[model samples]
Target: MAAGTATTAPTPEPAGRRLLRGKSWLATVPLLLFFLIGFGLPAVAIVTGAFTVSSDAETGAGSFTTANVTDSVQGAYWTALLSSIKLSALTALIGTAVGVPIAQAVLTSRFRMLREAVLTASGVLANFGGLPLAFAFVATLGNAGELTKLFHLTDHGWSLYSFTGLTVAYLYFLVPLMVLTITPALEGLRVQWREAAQNNRATGLQYWRHVALPILFPSLLGGFVLLFGSAFAAYATAAAMVGATVPLISRQIADALSGNVLVGQGNLALALSLDMIIVAVLVMAVYLPLQRRSARWLS
Candidate 1:
């Protein structure tokens, strides 16, 4: 009300509010420390070890170089990396193909309980991977197993240890994961769009081909890449089912890190881990944009 003075903004915020803000930030300290200990430290070790020479005399601070990285991707390791990529790409595509329809059906269902049941099942099956899943598959389809005996699979010649078999096993979990992810995206597909297409004399197939598929494409592709990363990083099931015969990069990384091999194995393993990290980063980079776009509709 003073002529020459201007009103203050209530001291911006009270001391108590400032203190609460500090406390809120302070609450994250434990989580930050946990991340530093659990992830940060390991990441540092991997990065350093990837570039650090194995036999340096400095002990604590070894000589740094990129020699390990170059060696990590050569010879057998290169083959393994390619193999892993192939396996992941194939399985992810297959999973998307299998999962999209199921998700769409769930999204379009009239019954809420049926939708809930399917989603609940998908969630359970998605996490039902690893060694246990492999073992179950083997028990049902392995040589002299129940299915092998009942269906006389030996006469039909279905070997469960091969690449095709591993793919089938991977599909068991991957499909359900796709179902869960794509369901939300499918739900984002508006009935209005379909009705509009129908109003314009478009058939269901034409609607999907022209409008629905285009809208859903980015989300579908992103899900495929997510599945790829999931399958790429998986170890326990692949290790249990196919072992070293599969020529997977994850298995090789484990072998290098297991301390059972050459002196430079640690550096090799770290380099491999760094490569995997880079790949996952690239995948996520593509995914983030598509995610933002897809989220626009859902939001």
Candidate 2:
């Protein structure tokens, strides 16, 4: 060997990398097309509709205007916005409270059979949504439901059509999502920290407060944002449970499009535009904090 340059043969591309690069374009083509068709075109149309209204007799041609937003902001739009925020906040808090404990149990338990059962049950529960899930709960918990009729619980006059019932349905979805998001973080926690704390005679609560909480705060908060987003966007569960009794923002928006809640095409478009704006703002607010926290973790 003449020098360091001559000491070894040059490295070659790994089989995995070569195969991936060679076939990646094939996979990307379908995905790119899907994104363009499914997301890009609809988004452009919504933006256009949000800015304009149909022309009246005074106007010769269809016109563009900003009044769609201004008009909505002045009307029931504000009420819907406030209601959505309140519901999302409540759902996020309740979901996080229930989910954190379930996630902790799932991640920390050394029982393999129990862990597998939890994973399987969670997977099934995660997909339980829409009207069917609502009716399932209704049939079991409602006044006419089996549980009610079988035990004469109907005398108690329980109903799954109240705001409280809607909250329960929302939690049914929210808790699973939180568990899914937090479990990975829980598992990723290094065992040594807990062991060290235990060796030092730290109580369970102290270990959680002083050792685990700081490490998991970012993930927990991110999971909270996810739960809030789910609750905010959900329509089916709310509609099935509350009907027209509770005027949730989503149900209202759906009614607008079908001319059942608010009248006029312009109003429907305006409501949808308002909803889009609210979602955009909420997503930005949640994601920015989450990103900053993640950056701090990396640092």
Candidate 3:
């Protein structure tokens, strides 16, 4: 019998492609480490701190109790929770209003130069949070601020320590995030889709309603949820804007820790517990809808 030629099965992928696939694990390592260090540690600390009660002045015991959580849920706690929900909802609404237009303007336009500038500004503005950022706004619009003085609106016209002022400061951050999130969704609107809609004689509003809005709504809602959650927990910015006029959850938490509250360090534990509960609920509420929307968009 003649010898049969040897046969070999083809490789699943080329060697070069396999090499890149194998290296994908490297990309995931940093993200895993980040979640472990940044998120994991703080979560553990908070849980431990909240449950374990204090014994001596500065020390806490290993035991657990529900008293802290119960005590922290009354009076000022209830008020702060309501204020947080209201403020966050308002911020999300405002962010959506301002961001949608800016995103639409940028994505639909052919101005490359302007797009870069707008994107850069959006990145900076989106990250403008915390105390320093708050102070920057204060310096520009506060009673003694430069622009306030120049515009002659500081003395008898406007007050920056009011809820309205806090809303504005929150908007400064929320708008940028909305722009960043929604711009991508807008850009993803395959040109063919728009052209096809136009070819069918659809008006701008009609096109948006039937095509654009559905596509962009997921991103818009996701961005709004993120900004809402951030605004809810926002400590430094609102604190600077309201000072003593408006009481926010973060400020109360601070008070608990720094002796501003009469309950001493117990209040700190209680406040932390409240913070944990509020954050957990907010996260779940926002995440569920966002996750659903994201899955819908993907499918």
- Tens digit of lDDT per residue, candidate 1, span 114-174? 9999999989999999989989988998886799999999898688888888899999999
Worst 10 residues of 3 by lDDT: 265-274
**Roughly what TM-score does model 1 have, to 2 decimal places?**
0.86
**Clash pairs of candidate 3?**
none
lDDT score, residue 37, model 3?
A: 100
> Which lDDT tens digits does candidate 2 get at residues 167-239?
7777887888788878877776777888999999999899999977877777788888878877787888778
Comparing 1 with 3 on lDDT, the higher-scoring candidate is 1
Query: What digit string (tens of lDDT, one per residue) describes model 3 on residues 167-201?
Result: 88899888988888877767667778879999999
**lDDT score for candidate 2 against the true structure:** 0.75
Candidate 1 overall Cα lDDT vs. reference?
0.88
Output candidate 1 Cα RMSD: 4.2
Native-to-model Cα distance after best TM-score fit, residue 87 in candidate 2, in Å:
1.6
Q: RMSD (Cα, Å) of candidate 2?
A: 4.2
After aligning candidate 2 to the native by TM-score, how far in Å is the CA of 180 from where it should be? 1.9
* Highest lDDT against the true fold, candidate: 1
Q: Best by TM-score, which number?
A: 1
Candidate 3 vs. true structure, TM-score: 0.81
